[model samples]
Target: MPAPQMMGIYPSDSISEVAHSLPIDPLGPGAADLLAGDVEYRLHLILQEAKKFMIHGKRATLLPEDVEYAMEALNVEPVLVPPRPLPIPSFQPVSVSSTSSSSHQAQQVYHTPDDEIDFAAYLKQPLPAGIASSAGVKWKAHWLAVEGVQPAIPENPAPGTSRAGPSRPQPASTSLRPQARAQLPQELQLYFTRLTTALVPPTPSAPETEPERHRLAALVSLRTDVAVAGILIYVIKWLSESIQKCLMAPTGTIGQLVDAVDAVLENEGLFVEPYMHQLLPPLLSIILTVPLGPHPPSSSSSSQPSPYDVRQRAAEVLGKIAEQYGKSYPGLIPRLVSTLTKALQSPPFPSPLGAAHPPAGRYEGAVLGLAALGSQAVKSGVWGKAGEGLSKIDELAGRLYIDGGKRKNPLIRATIKALSPLITAKPADVQAPQINMNEVTNAFGPYIANGLVKKGWTANELLRLRKEEMEEGEGGGEGMDMDTPRI
Candidate 1:
C-alpha cells in the first residue's frame, strides 16, 4: 500500500461559509478549523489520485471528472438525493364562454390533487418519433470568387457597384460612388503574405525544394480564393526566373509551377485584370534574353545549351495567354512582337568562346518567341512585308541560317525552324493567260501610226491612210515594214 500524501491546509473561513450555505448551523470557533482540516485532507487525497488518472490518460491538465472517478475508487460515498416522484392528476370540466370560440387555446379543465404517477409504466413508454438523440451538422464546399473577382452566387453575389443597373433615388448631397476601396480580410492577407514569402525567393541562393512546392500546390488549389490572385504577379515573376535557372530541372516539378501560373492567368472571373501589364514583362524578358536567372553567367559556355529550352516554355505560355486574353488586353500582342524583334537585334556579349554565339543564341530565342506568337506577329507587321523592320528581320534570319555555318548550334536550328513556317510556299494556282500579247500589239500599231503622222498631213487623211494600211496588213497576214512608217 502507498503512503498517504499531505498538502497545505485550506482557510477555515471559506469552509465555514460553505457549511453555512449547506443548510447547516454555523460551526463555533475551532470547530470550523477542524471541519476545514478534514475537508482539505480528503480533497488532497482525491487530487493526488486524480493526477494518476490524468497521467494514465496522457493529459497535462486535470479535470473535474477525474476527481469524481478518484473518489469512487477511494470508496468515498457521494452526497445522495432521492429522486422525487412525478405527480398525476384527475381531470374535471370547467366553464367556457361562447365568445371565445375562435381562440386557439384549449378548453379549461380542473385537476384533483390526490392522484399519483405510475413511475414503472411511464419508464416503459416508447420515445416519441422524429425526436433526435443528438444534434447533427453537415459541411458543404464552394468558391466565392476566382482570382480577385467575386462571382455571382446565392451566398456571395457580385457587389452592387460591379453590376450595371438603374440607381435608386438618393439625396443630392451624397456622392453616388463608394468613398474608398474595402480592406482585405485578415486571414486571406496573412495567407498570401506567407505564400509570397515561401514561393518567392527573397535571396538568390534559396534552393527550390519539395516543401515550398507543396505549399504552392495547396495555394494553387484555392483558385477561387480571389484575395490571393493579386499576389500571383510576384509569384509568376519568381517562377519565370526559377524556370530560367532550372531549365534542366525535373520536368514534372517545373511543369507544375508553370501550370499554376497559367491557371491564374486563365481564370475568367478574377478582377485583377489590369495586372496583366505587369505579369507579361518578366516572361517576355525570359523568352528574349539568354541566361535569365538572377545570377546569369555573363560569358557563353558549353554548359548552357543556349536558350532553346527556357524560351520554348516561355513562348508556349505567351502564345496561350495571347490567345486567351488577346482582345481584353490589346497591348500584350504588340509588346511581345516588339520585344522579340528588339531582342533579335540586341548585340551579343563579347565572349572568348565566340562573340557571335551569344547574340545568335539570343536571336534564336527571339525567333522561337515569334514562332510561338504565330500569326499575331505576322499580322502586327513584325515579319510583315510593309516595314524596314520586316526586311531587316528577314535579312538577319537569313544571315544566321546561311552564313553562320554552325549547323550544330541551337540558335541556327531554332532560326531555321522559326523562318520555315513563314517562308514555306504552297503550290501556286496556275492559270492560262487571259489575253495574247501578239494580237494586242497588232491592234495598237495603226493608232500609233496615226498619232505619229507628219505635220502636213490632215488628221482625217492620216486616219484614213492608217485604216487602209491596217486592212491591207490584216488581209495579207504579213508583218508591217519598219522603213515605211516610223511608228
Candidate 2:
C-alpha cells in the first residue's frame, strides 16, 4: 500500500516551475518530489508550533506573531513582517477556458491579491497624535487570599456568576453591606490588602521575622504615605471589624490594629478630623467592653501581652486623637470623658435581685482612658470634690476591698495611674506638707485618699490642683462643665 498523504501537499509541478523560473537547471522528477515532500513536512511543523503558541496565549485564532515566535523556537530563520491592521487575505477562485477547442472543460485556480496603498494620498493626510509614554514599571505585592478566603479586591478577577440565569435580589437587612471594593483603583486595593494582612498576620511571627518587618513597614507607610486618603474609609472599616472579631479572644492583632490607628492619626498629610466620629466608637469599645480576652494564667511565661495591654494601647490612641483634634472639635474630649466616666461609675456591686453588674475590667479600662486625656480630664472625671466626682469609684473600691483585699489591688493601681498626671512632687529643698491620714481619708474618701498618699501627694497639693482644674473648667466653656459635677 502507498504511504498515507500528509495534511499539506507542495506539488512537484510547483517545485519544478519555481526551479525553472530561477537561474538554475530544471530539477529531476525524483529531486522535485523529494523537495516537495520536505517542504510540506517543514510547513506542517511550523503550523503545529504556531498552533501551540496560540493555545498558550489563550487565543483561538493563530496570529502572525505566533508564527514568528514558533519559527524562533524551532530554530528556523523568522520572517520579519511589519504588523498590519487587517487580517491575512483569503484566496479568490478564477475559472479559465481551456486553450484547445477539443477540451471543453474550464480549469480553476485560486489566487491571493496583493494589498494596494496610495502613497500620494497617505502623505497628504494629517499625522496622528503620538501616544503619551506610560509611567515606569515597578513591583507591587498584594494578598490574593487569607485563610483560604479570597478578599474582594480589584487585583483579583471578579468571582464568576452565571449570566445566562436571572439574578436573584438579596433581601435587605439591618447589617451594612460591605463597600463596593471593585470600584477602587488597583493600586489602592493592593495597598489596603498588604497593610491589613501585615497588621494581622495569619501566622504569628517572632519579633525578628519577616512578618514583623512587614508589619512595621506597613505601619510606616500608614504614617507617612500622602496618597492614602482614598483608602481611609476602608482601612477604618477593616479596623472596626477586626477589633470586634478579636475582642472576645484578644491577640497581638488587637494591639497591632490600635497601632495602625495611631499610625493613621500620626500621618500629617491626612485630614482625620472628618472621620473622628467613626474612629472614636472603636476606640471607646476597646475601652469599655468587658472580657477582652481570657485572663492569662499567673504562672505562664509567654511573651505575649495581655488584654489589658491592648486596652492601654487603645487608650493611648484615644489620647492622640484628643490632643490632635481637641481644639478643632472641643466637644470631643468632653464626650469621651462622659462615656468613660459612665463606665467607671457603673455599680460593680452584685444586685440583690440577681441582676448582672459591670466587671472590674471595665472600670480599669475607664481609668486608663481618663488618665490618657491629661491632667484636667483626670481631675474633672476622676477627682471630684466630696460626693460629686469619683464618689462611685471610692464606694466600688471599698466594697471590693471588704469582699477580697487582693481583688481591690487592681482598682487601686488603676486609680493611682489615673492620678499620675495630677501628681507633682514638691522640690527637694521645700518641706512636703504633712497631713493627718484621718483628715485625708475624710476629705476625699478612703479609696482615692490612699492612692494619693501612695503617690506622696499632700492634701494641700490635691486641693490646689482640684481648685485650679475647677477654675479652668469654668473658664473653658459650657462643654467642660458637662463632665464636671455641680458644686
Candidate 1 CA-lDDT value: 0.54
Stretches > 4 Å off in candidate 1 = 1-184, 197-209, 212-219, 222-260, 294-306, 329-331, 346-357, 376-408, 419-487
Q: What's the TM-score of each model vs. the native? A: 0.37, 0.54
Which lDDT values do the candidates have, in the order given? 0.54, 0.73
> lDDT tens string, model 2, 1-487?
4444434468878888889889987675377777888998899899999999999999999998999988999999966656877777799989988898889899988999778989878656654444224355334468899998777788876767434453422111212234545667767777777777777666556788999999899899999998778888777777767676666543465677788889999998888778887788888888877666534323332556776777888999999999988998888889989988887777774533343543566787888899899988787778765325655677777665555332435666777677766667677887666666676566566776666664445566666665677677667777667657855
Clashes of each: 2, 0
Which candidate ranks first by TM-score, i.e. highest? 2
lDDT of 1 at 122: 62
Q: What range of 10 consecutive residues in model 2 has the weakest lDDT sum?
A: 168-177
* TM-score (C-alpha, index-matched) for candidate 1: 0.37
Clashing residue pairs, backbone N/CA/C < 3 A, model 2: none
Compose the digit string of candidate 1's lDDT tens values, residues 213-257.
655665464455665564454444555555554433333333344
- What is the number of residue pairs that collide in model 1? 2
